[model samples]
Every structure is written in structure tokens, then in C-alpha cells.
Target: MEINGVEIEDNFAEAFGIQVSRILITAATKKLALVAATEATGYGTSVIGCPAEAGIDGYVPPQDTPDGRPGYIIMICNMNKGKLDHELLERVGMCILTAATTAVFDWMDEPDEKLKTGQKLKFFGDGYEQTLDVEGRKIHSIPLMSGDFLVEAELGIKAGVAGGNFFILAENQPAGLLAADAAVDAIEAIPGAITPFPGGIVASGSKVGSNKYKFLGASTNEKMCVTLKDEVEGCEIPENVNGVYEIVIDGVNEEAVKAAMKAGIEAAVKISGIIQISAGNFGGNLGKYQIKLHELF
Candidate 1:
């Protein structure tokens, strides 16, 4: 299939099931809220190496927030529920609680697990911590140097989808990067979805394991590398495709992930020098969901 004259490879993006915690972080202003959100989601590019995979889903207006303050929604995802709970606790406690004028609230309504993140972090307040009902929700008030930190007593975690991804092949490096930037911008508007890679773009895409390194769990996907197109056997890089970038998306559900991919691909094809769109998969050997790229249109 072709979109905006750019070829869409007949491929599918394989995605796996994972646990997710959606948190609404509010602050005195949008800038402060974004600051906390960015910090909490930092170093969360991929669960392959990182403790967790996370990103800012979107911004929440004051009128829509539980605290009536400007906030940002973030999603933290992990394969194991126990690890996801721990990640939630650590990120909120260390990142959000330390940020000035920041507060956290549960964004998921029906969660498979409820974590006492606030209850655990309240220890930072010593004996002065207090619990109160605000907006019909229980909140922990922890005293800090700037002011009292408010966190929802309980945070929710639900099963979500992860590792939804696609590739952007372009004529040159600048074109590939620009196309990736446009794709990330489109995915940012998608609710319940996030691109966790740095700036929502993956410069180095990897495969299941390393061929040379026995201890490594993942290594570069040489087949998709434009630089190795001639050197690597069975390479997927076309003759004219000199630059390639990957966009990995994680979301609350399969539908959200699919929507983000479709939006990103469509937006990317409009960029100049975009040659083709494709996806990565383990020949249907891994992941639970296989989203077809051609079917998206």
C-alpha cells in the first residue's frame, strides 16, 4: 500500500502485553507539571535495559484534572506487575515528590492492581504526614521544604500493550530525522499512547539477541541498517534508503497503540524524502499483537 506516494511495506508491528500505571501529575503551572513528568519518565526508553518504559502521554487542562490544576499524564510500563509497582513507587516518590509544587493522582479507573505508593512515600514526612479526603479521593499530605506534597493514597495499575513500533526509511539523515520528528508530534496527540524512546525516536533499533556477544540480550538490527545494506546479508534496506529511524509506542490498549502507529505513519509520509514505512517483528514468534501496516489505512 502507498500513502502520500510513500511505499508501505506489507509488515506488522509485534507488541507484547505489559502492566501499566497511568499517573496524572499536577503542579502550580504547566511548566512545573511538565518538569516533574519529564524527570519521572527519564531513562525509561526501553525495558530491555531500563527499569521500566515510560513517557508523557499528554497534558491535562486544569478543568479536567482532579486537583483543578494543570497536569501531565504519564504512563509507566513493565512486563512484571511487581516490578511495575516498584517503578511506580520509585518514580513518584523520588521524581514527583521532589519537584516543586507537584502532586500525583491515579489516572486509571479500573486497575488490575492497586499500589500504596503514597502510603509508602508518606514516610518521608515522618510523623507529620496526614491523610485527607479531597474531591472524594484519599490523598496523602507529606510535608516538604517548599510545601506539603499531595499524592493520591492509592495508584492503579492495569494490563497494557507495549513494543508497538514502525520504521521510517528516508533518502538522507536530515530527511529521516525530520520525518521522525513529525511522526512523534502526531503520536503525542494520541491519548493512552506514548513513544518512550528519546524524543520519541529510536536511532538504534535492536533485535532479540546479539550474534557476537553471548551475554547480551539484544543487539543492533543489522538487517535494517542502511550503512550495512550491502555488507549485511538479507538486509531490508532498499538501494535508495540511506537513513532509517524507528518509532516505538506503548499504550493502555491495543487500539490506542494501533491508532498512534497509523497517525505516525500517515504524518511521516507527508514529509519530503520519506521513501517507505515498515515494521519490526520476530516472524510472529514473539509478542501477542501483530498490527498490520497496510490494514491501518
Candidate 2:
């Protein structure tokens, strides 16, 4: 199939099941809220190395939030339950709690499980923690030098899909980067999904394992590398295509992820110099969900 003159390869993106928690970070001002959200999601790009895969879903208006303050929605995902619990504790306690005039709330209305993150962090209040009823929801208020930091008693965790991705093949680096940026911008409008990589673009896409190093869990996807097109056997890079960028998405469910991929691909193909669009898979070895590119249409 072709879109806007760009060929769409007959392939699928393999995704895996993961647990996710959506949270709202609100603060006295929009700047503070964004700062806290960014800090909380920091160093969370890929689960292969980072403790979690996380990113800002979008910003919320003051009137729409629980605390009547400007805030940002963020989603954090992990494959392990213990690790996700610990990550939420550390991120909420150290990142959001330390930020000025910040408050955290569970954004999920219905979750598969609940983690007592705020219940655990409440001890830092040093016996001064007070439980308050806000808008029919229980909240924990912990005193700080800046003021009181409020958090929900428990955070809701739900099953989500991860590793939904697509490759943008372009004639050059500038074209590829521009297409990737456009795709990320389009995905940002989608609800219940997030592109977790830095700026929502993966410059160094990896495969399951290294070709030379056995110890590495993942290494450069040599077949897709433009620089290695001549040297790597079975190179997927098309002739005249010198740049490629991958957009990795994690969503609340399969539907959300599929919507993101569709939106991203549609926006990317509109950009000039795009050669083709393709997806990565490992012969059904990567994960259970095989999202076919053609089926998206």
C-alpha cells in the first residue's frame, strides 16, 4: 500500500503486554506542574535499560484537574509488578513530592490493580500526615518546607500494550528527523497513549540481541541502519534512503496503540522526502500482538 506517494511495507509491529499507571501532576503554576512531570518521567525512555517506560501524555487545564490547578498527565509502564511499585514510590516521593506546590492523583478511573504508593510515602510526613477528603476522593497531605504536598492514597495500575512502533525511511537525515517530529506531534493528540523515547523519536533503534556481543540484551538493528546498508547482510534500507527514525509507543490498550500508529503514519507520509514506512518484528518472537500495517487502513 502507498500513502502520499510513500510505500507502506507489508509488515507488522510486535507488541507486548505491560502494566501501566497514569497519574496527574498538578502544581501552583503551569511551569511547576510541567517541571514536576518532566522530572518524574526522567530517565524513562525504554524498559530494556530504564526501570520504566514513561512520557507525558498531555497537559490538563486548571478547571479540569482535581486540585483546580494546571497539570500534566503522565503514564509509566513496566513489565514487572515489584519494579513498577518501587518506581512509582521513588518517582513520586523524590520527584513530584520535592517539587514546589505539587500534588499527585491517580488518573485511571478503573484499574486492574492498585499500588499503595502514597500510603508508603506518607510516612515521610514523620507522623504529621493528614488524610483529607477532596472531591469525594481520599488524599494524603504531607507537610514540607514549601508547604503541603498532597497525593492520592493509592495509585491505579492497569494492563497496557507496549512496543508499538514504525520506521520512517527518508532520503536524508533532515527529512527523517522532520518526519519523526511530525509523527510525534500527531501522536500527542491521541489519548491514552505516549511515545516514551527522548522527544518521542528513537535515533538508535535496537534489535533483540547483538550480532557480535552475546552479553548484550539489545544492540543496533544493523539491517535497518543506513550507514551499514552496504556492509550488513539483508539490509532493509532501500536505495537512496539514507536516514531512518523509529517512533515507539505505549498505550492503555491495543486500540489506543493502534490509533497512535495510524495517526503517526498518516502524518509522517505527508512530509516531503519520505521514501517508505515499515514496521519491525522478530518472526513473532518479540511479542504476542502483531499489528499489521495494512490492517490499519
Candidate 3:
């Protein structure tokens, strides 16, 4: 299929089922909200490498949010519920709750979901913990040196898809980055999705194994590396195409990832110097969720 003259591959993007937590961070303004969200999602590009995979789901308008300030919704995912809870407590405690003028809430709609955010973070209060219930959500207020930190009692956990991605083959590094930026911008408006990379693009993609190191689980994908094109097997660098970048996304489910990938690929392939749109997969050995790109579009 062609989107604005760029070819869309028939390949599928593989995804895995993992536990996810939705966190709503409210701050005094949109700027602070963005900062808290960015910090919360930082270094959470992939669960394969990072402790968790997370990203800003989207922004909530002041009228729609509980705190009446601009808010951000971020989703954190892990291989299991225990890992998800640990990472959520660590990241949200250090990143969001510590940020100035910020308060956290359970973004999950289900009331029965376990919420350990406040339960874990209330220790920062050093025995001065106070709890309040607002609009059916429990908020724990912990007194701090700076002020009181407020967080919800429980966070919602659900099954989510991880490792949704697409590769951008471009004429140069700048072109690839520009195309990736456009793709990120286009999909930022999509709900329940996020690209958790440094600037939302991965320049160095990894392979499943290493030739020299027996202990290494993953090393660089040498064939896809432009600098080592001459030595690696299956190197397919087209003339004038010197750079490749990958856009990885995490979402609430397979359909969400599939929809976001379609929009992302469409936006990316429109840019000049972009040659091909592809994806990363484990040859159906890893993930339980499979998204067919052509069928999605």
C-alpha cells in the first residue's frame, strides 16, 4: 500500500502482553505537567532494556482533570504486576510526586484495582501521613520539607502491548530524524499511546545476540548500522540512504498500537528522503500479540 507515494510494508509488528499502570499527574500549569510527564517516562523506552516501558498517554485539559490544572496521563508497563508496582513507586515517587506543584491520581476507571502508589510513598512523610478521599479516589498527603505530597491510594493495572515499532530508512541522519520527529508529532494526539525514546527515536537498534560475548543477551544490529554496512550480513543500504531510525511505541492494547503505528508510518513516509517503512519483530517467537501493518491501515 502507498501513503503519499511511500510504500507501506505487508509485514506485521509483534507485541507482548504486560502489566500496565495509568498515572495522571497534575501540576500548576501545562509546563510543569509536561516536565513531570517527561521525567516520569524518561529512560522507559523498552522493557527489554529498561526496567519498564512507559510514555505519556496524552494531556488532559484543565476542565477535564480533577486538580483543575493541566495534567498528563502516563502509562507504565512491565512483564509482571510486581515489577510494575515497583517501577511505578520508584519513578512516580522520585519523579512526579517530588516535582513542584504536582499531585498524582489513579487514572484507571476500575475501582477494584490495587493502588500502591500512596501506600508506598507515604513513608516519605515519616509518620505524618494523612489520607483523604475525593471523588471516590483515596489521596494520601505526606508532609515534606518543601510541602505536602499528594498521591492516590491505588493505581490501575491492565494488560498492554509493548514493542510496537517502525523503521525509517532515510537518505541521511538529519532526514531520518526529521521524519521521525514528524511521526512523533503526528501520533502525540493519539490517546493511550506513547513513544518512549530519547527524542522519540532510536538511532541504535539492538540485535538478539552477540558473536564475541557469551554473556551478552543483545548487541547492536550491525547490518542495520550505516557505519558498518560493508561488513555485516544482509546489509541493505540503498545509495544515498545513510541513516535508519526506529520509532517504538507502547499502548493499552494491540489495536491501539496498530492504530498508532499506522498513523506514525503514514506521517513518517511523507517526508522527503524517506525510503522504506519497516518494523522490528522476533520472528513470532517472543510476543503473543501480532499486528499486521497493511491490514491495520
Candidate 4:
């Protein structure tokens, strides 16, 4: 199939099931909220090599927030529930509490697992912590040198799909970069979906393991490497394709992931120099949720 003249490869992006925690961080302004949210989600690119995978789901307006402040919605996903709860506690305690005028709130309703994120962090108050009701939501306040850090008592965790991805192949580096930028901008606007990589683009896509190193969990995706096309097996790089950037998406459900991928691919297809749109998968071994690229359109 072709979208806006760009060929859509008949491939699927591999996805795996994992646990996710949705938290809304509020601050005096959107700037502060985003700053705290970004710091907390740093180093959370992939679960294969990193501790967890996380990204900003979106922003919450002040009037809609419990504390009447601008908020950033962040999603942290892990392989298991125990790790998800632990990461949430550490991230919220160190990142949000240390930042000035910042607070966090649980964004999920009727979650399968409730994590005591704020209740655990309130210990920093050392018995001087207090509780309040803001807009019918319970808020826990922890005393700090700057002021009190307010957070919701609990965060909700549920099963989610991760590692959903697609490749944007272009004729040059600049074209690939532009297409990736436009795709991420469009994907970021979709709810319940997030691209965890820096700038929402993965230049160094990887396979399951390394061929040379035993300790390496993942290695370069040789098939898509244009320069190594002559030396690699199963090379998927076309002769004219010089640049390939992958967009990995994580979402609350399969539908949200499909919507984000559809928007991203459509946006990239309109950009000049985009040659083909493809996906990365391990034949469904990695995860059960395989998003077919052509099915999205």
C-alpha cells in the first residue's frame, strides 16, 4: 500500500506486555511541571538496557487538576508490578519532591494495582506530614526546606503494551530527521501514547542480542544499516535509502498505539524524500501485540 506516495511495507512492529503507572505531576506552571516530569523519566528509554521505559503522556490544565495547577501526565512502564511500584516511589520522591513547587497525582481510575507512591514518599516529612482534600481528591503533603511537596496518596498500575515501533526510511539524514520530527510532533498529540526515545526518534535500532559480545543484551539492527548493507545478512536497507529512523511507541492499549502510529506514518509520508514505511518485529516472539503497519491505514 502507498500513503501519499510513500510505500507502506507489509510488516508489523513487535510489542510486549508490561505494567504501567500513570501519574500526573502538577506545579506552579507548565514549565516547572514539564521539567520535573522530564527529569523523572530520564534514562527510561528501554527495559532491555534501562531500568524502565517512560515518557510524557500529555499535559493537564490547571482547572482540571486537583490542586489547580498545570500538570504533566507521565507513564512509567516496567516488566513487572514490583519494579513499577519501586520506580514510581524513587522517581517521585527524588525528582518531583526536590523540584520547587511540584506535586504529583494519580491519573488512573479503577486501576488493577494501586501503588502507594505519595504515602511512601511522605516519610520524608518525618512525622510532620499532613493531608488535605482538594477537589475531592486526597493529597499528601511532605515538608521540605523550600516548602511542602503535595502528591496524591496513590498511583495506579495496569497492564500495557510496549515496544511498538515503525521505521521511516528517507534518502538522506536531513530528510529522515525532518520526517521523524514531524511524526513525533503528531504522535505526541495523541492521548494514552508516548514515544520514549530522545526527540521520539530511535536512530540506533537494535535486535535481541549481540553476535560478538555475550554480555550485550542488544546490538545494532544490521539489516536496516545502510552502510553495512553489503556486509550484513538479512539486510532490509534499500539501495537508495540512506537514512532510517524508528519511532517506538508505548500506549495504554493496542488501539491507542495504533492511532499514534497511524498519525505518525501519515505525517511522515507527506514529507519529501520519505521512501518507505516499515516496522520491526521478532515474529511475535517478543510480544503478543503485533501492530501491522498496513492495517493502521
> Which candidate leads the pack in TM-score?
2
Query: lDDT of all predictions, in order shown?
Result: 0.94, 0.95, 0.82, 0.90
Give candidate 4's error at residue 258 in angstroms. Answer: 0.9
My TM-score estimates for the predictions, one after another, are 0.98, 0.99, 0.93, 0.97
What would the TM-score be for candidate 2 when compared with the true structure? 0.99
lDDT of 2 by residue, 3-68 (tens): 999999999999999999999999999999999999999999999999999999999999999989
Tell me how candidate 1 scores on lDDT: 0.94
Q: Which residue runs of candidate 2 sit more than 4 Å off their true CA positions?
A: none
User: How much is 64 displaced in model 2, in angstroms?
Assistant: 0.6
Query: Candidate 4's residue-wise lDDT over 211-246, tens digit each?
Result: 899899899888988889789888898989999999
- Identify the candidate with maximal lDDT: 2
lDDT of 4: 0.90
Rank by lDDT (best first)? 2, 1, 4, 3
Q: What is the lDDT of residue 103 in candidate 4?
A: 87
Badly placed stretches (over 4 Å) of model 3 are: 109-112
lDDT pick, better of 1 and 2: 2
Q: For model 1, where is the 10-residue window of minimal lDDT?
A: 109-118
Question: What is the Å distance of residue 172 in model 2 from its true position?
Answer: 0.6
